[model samples]
Structure formats: structure tokens, C-alpha cells
Target: MLQAREGTCNWKANAASGMAVHDDCKLRFLELKAKRTHRFIVFKIEEKQKQVVVEKVGEPTQNYDDFTASLPVDECRYAVYDFDFVTAENCQKSRIFFIAWSPDTSRVRSKMIYASSKDRFKRELDGIQVELQATDPTEMGLDVIKSRAN
Candidate 1:
């Protein structure tokens, strides 16, 4: 079994414009502090299995399967997609949360992303590059999530 280690480093702004753990060595829980929304975007990665398990901390739970299905490929060696969106109860605007996990956890290659501006999402896997875009926010997020999964 893989040991789950939660990180407690000070939060810093990421390239995607959200708060993330300062140190890159931790691998248990990554918290993405939403700028627009106070709610947090968090998830965990299993180092041994190379799988990511996302918890619905402040996001809707109903669309998780769809989020997983929309991945670029049917199977993935290492990848993760997590985010928060506008819901019926939460009318406030929210940014999309994404985590691109590298296949090798021993090295630091994963990405923490928070996007809400563009329509297109791009990613590269196993030397293959893919770009996805949609007019809809949900679809666009799904496309990005799916692309990373591949």
C-alpha cells in the first residue's frame, strides 16, 4: 500500500493563478485555493498505483464520471483532473482546477492548473500532443481533463 502524505507547506500562487503548496516534494494532498470562490480545490495521488483520486471538496459530485470518461484515452498510466464549477446552489463564478500528474512520481513533473479564461485546453502525452476547445465551460474543462487522462 502507498503511504498517503499530506503537505503542509505555505501556499503560493501557481502559473494558473491559484494557491498551491510551496514545495513540490509532497504527494498526498494538493490544495488549489480558488481565487474567485473561497472554496478549495483539492485531490490526492497514489504513488504506488500512479492513480489520482479526486475528492469533491467544494465541487459537484454528480459529474465526476463524465469528467473521467471524457479523458483522451480509455486508459492512462498517470494523469489527474479535478475542478470546481458553477452549480445550482453555488451561483458564484468558479475557476477550473486541473492536475497533470507525471507518470514517474519519484521526479517532479506534475502540474497544478487553474484556468477560466480560454476555450481551448492543450496537453501532451507519450510524445503525442492534443488540443481541445469548446464554447461551453464544462465541456472545455472536460476536454482538458480528458486530454490529461490520455
Candidate 2:
């Protein structure tokens, strides 16, 4: 088994949960233990509106309300899927802040999400919603956010 560097793994459990080799890329999976401590929110680009819509996957709460934001769609190059959390009953308590846009218009991918963190992750979605509003898509790319424990 591979070992996780200290502070790299956020969960209460050990970090280096599993590993896989895909061609030239080596992938490591973070293991978030039980307790329904994290939340899951999803955002997809609205091509027609030239914006992004963010919504919580489950029951709505003060912290998990839906939100919408405008982006520099023409300037955005791509939407990258950095990582995902696989939870039971789909009760995610952490916020995965991965939405980002590249300034290089030539990249032309439209949307991107780059979430970076380890176990016990529990970042709030509402907070991210606010951040997205202030973010200038053209100037910021590759922002690493986290999923937090409830």
C-alpha cells in the first residue's frame, strides 16, 4: 500500500486508501470513512445562458442552497474533473469546489472542476458559491477546494 504524506490526508482515517496505474498516469484514491460527514454539490455549464448553475445533490439546507453565476464562457477553455467522492445513499456532507475556467480562450473546454483534498473532507458549498461569484474566470485557474466532514 502507498503511504499518504502527512497533512495531505484530511480524514480521520489513514490517507493512502488505494492506488491505480492508468497508462502513464498514477492515480490515488482517498478513502472517506462512514459518518455522513461530507456534502456533495454539482455544477454544470449552461451553454445557452453563458453561465454555470450550482445545486446541491440532496436535501436543501441553509448551507446547501442552489445558486447561479455568470462566467467568461467565451474565455473559458475547459471543465476539468479533478476528483469525486463515492458515498453511500449519496449523502455527501462536504463541498467539492472544483469549478474553474482558463483564461486561454483557445483551450475551449468550456468548464472545469479541480477538487484537491483527502479523507474526512467537509468543505461547505454555500461558501464556494460566494467565492465563485467573486472569481474572475479569466484570471483564475486550477483552484483547489475541499470537501468537509459534517
Candidate 3:
């Protein structure tokens, strides 16, 4: 049987979930942040590897629809989106949103794992302004995001 090594820095595993956040996840996030190289990123837990991995990165030109379309209909995922909007004062602003998507149709086990690992994962990304959890598409619709941005 495989046993977890305590205090090992190589895998950044969370004690409660035994899930590690892959290094590339943070690296890609940095690119999106410092360079404006990406519009969004999608993350998923690889059950077999017990690690959270970067599954997709949306191009800078991609829209909200592209981000929404990236999420699986029957799975749980973690994502970060750079949302741009015009405020009431006509100021153009952008906010980095961290979204936890656990669709109702996903397996309970998957939902629980993602929930347990979310805090640890998000803590590593640094600079996320808004956090949203959704169990359905409507819960994360553009209108909802716009409201949250304000």
C-alpha cells in the first residue's frame, strides 16, 4: 500500500483531500496575470494522480461564452476568469474571478473532493478578487457575473 509522506514539499498535497495542486497551474495563472496572455483557465482533479491539473487555457480573445463552454456538463471543475466590465461611472475595470463549478449531475464523490481541495488550491493562486460556486450554468451566467463585478 502507498502511504503519504508528511511534510514533503515536492507534491503540495492537502492533508484533508490528499490532492496536490500541480505546479503548472500556478505558472499558467501567472502568465494570465502578468502578461494578459490568457482570458481564463480551467482546472480538474485527476483522480488517479490525486492532483489538480490545468486542463485548458482560454486565449486572450475568448469571450465569456468560451469560458462557460469549457466547463463539462456533468463534472466538477475549478476556473479563473479575467472579467472586464464598465462600471456605473464609465470606468473600465477588470477582476479575476475564481469559480468553482460543481454541476448537479456530477458524482457526489467528485463534488466532495473538489470542495475539499478548493481552498488549498485557490490559496496558491494569489490575486483572485471574486469567488463563485455554481451547481448549474445559470448560477454562473454573465448577468450574475456582471452583478458580482459591481
Candidate 4:
């Protein structure tokens, strides 16, 4: 059996103005953050010292997916997101949230994510990614959160 790891995913401002986290990395994080309606933007792939860096642009994106998707491809695209971990209704539970907008063409199943909530679901880190694709938030009986007026 697999075990879960206790670690936090850091959200930083995007290094590049127009980038996206590749087509595959959009996970539940993006979904949850979008629900929060935080102000942020995505950027395309950024390479330095032969390594790839994905981060939040620190800029607010109008259409989450559209902004990132707008990243220059043929070059490479990545969705860099910014988020804060705060104590939600469940004090003991820390909520990692993100706000984003993606086109309908964008999919949550593209990349691997940390499937379940730390205490609520599976106990594996990698499992989260697998689970992300396994279920659809809107269709999985999740509450419908309406978008606020801009």
C-alpha cells in the first residue's frame, strides 16, 4: 500500500506575466481557488539553469484559463498561481485555496494532484493527483459556488 506525506504546496507570484502550468497541472487547487475568487494571474513556462519553474504571476487574471491559456505555446505554457493557506471553518484544518478561470477546453484531469483533503480522504500525496482526475468537482455533488460581481 502507499502512504501519505505531510507537505504544503507553495503558491508564489508568476515569474512571467503570461504563462500557464502546462496543460496537465491544473488540479483541484485551481478549482478550489477559482471558487474563492482571489486576485491572481498565470504565466507560461520559465526555464533557468536548465530547470523549469512554475509560479503565480501575482497579477490578477480576468479569465483564469484564458489568461494562462494565452501563454505563448510552441514556446511552452504554465499556469503560475498565488494562494494562501488559512484556517477555514475547521480550525484544525488548513485550507489551501486558489482562484482561477480556465476555458471549457481546460481540464482538471490533465495533471496529477493531491487527491483528497488531508483528514477526509486518502492518505497519500500522489493519490491526490490521481483522485483529482477521478472525480469532477461540479459533478461530484460539490456545492455550487456562484461567482461574485466584479
In order, what lDDT does every prediction score?
A: 0.32, 0.29, 0.93, 0.29
What's the ranking of the predictions by TM-score, best on top?
3, 4, 2, 1
Candidates ranked by lDDT: 3, 1, 2, 4
Ranked by TM-score, the better of candidates 2 and 3 is 3
- Give each prediction's root-mean-square deviation over alpha carbons: 16.5, 16.9, 5.2, 13.5
List of clashing residue pairs for candidate 3: none
Q: What's the lDDT of the predicted structure labeled candidate 1? A: 0.32
Candidate 1's residue-wise lDDT over 63-122, tens digit each?
Answer: 555554444331221222334445557564333344332222223333222121111121
Q: Judged by TM-score relative to the true structure, which candidate is superior, 1 or 3?
A: 3
- Model 1 TM: 0.20
Number of the candidate with higher lDDT, 3 or 4: 3
Q: How do the residues 1-150 of candidate 2 rate in per-residue lDDT, one tens digit apiece?
A: 245654455552232222111211111111111222233333333445433344223222213222122333444312212223345678544433434443444233332321111111113221332133123442333232333221
Find the 10 residues in a row with the least total lDDT in model 4: 141-150
Model 2, residue 1: what's the lDDT? 25
Off by over 4 Å in 4: 1-48, 54-61, 80-150
TM-score against native, each model: 0.20, 0.22, 0.89, 0.24
**Which stretches of candidate 2 lie above 4 Å from their native place?**
1-38, 59-107, 111-150
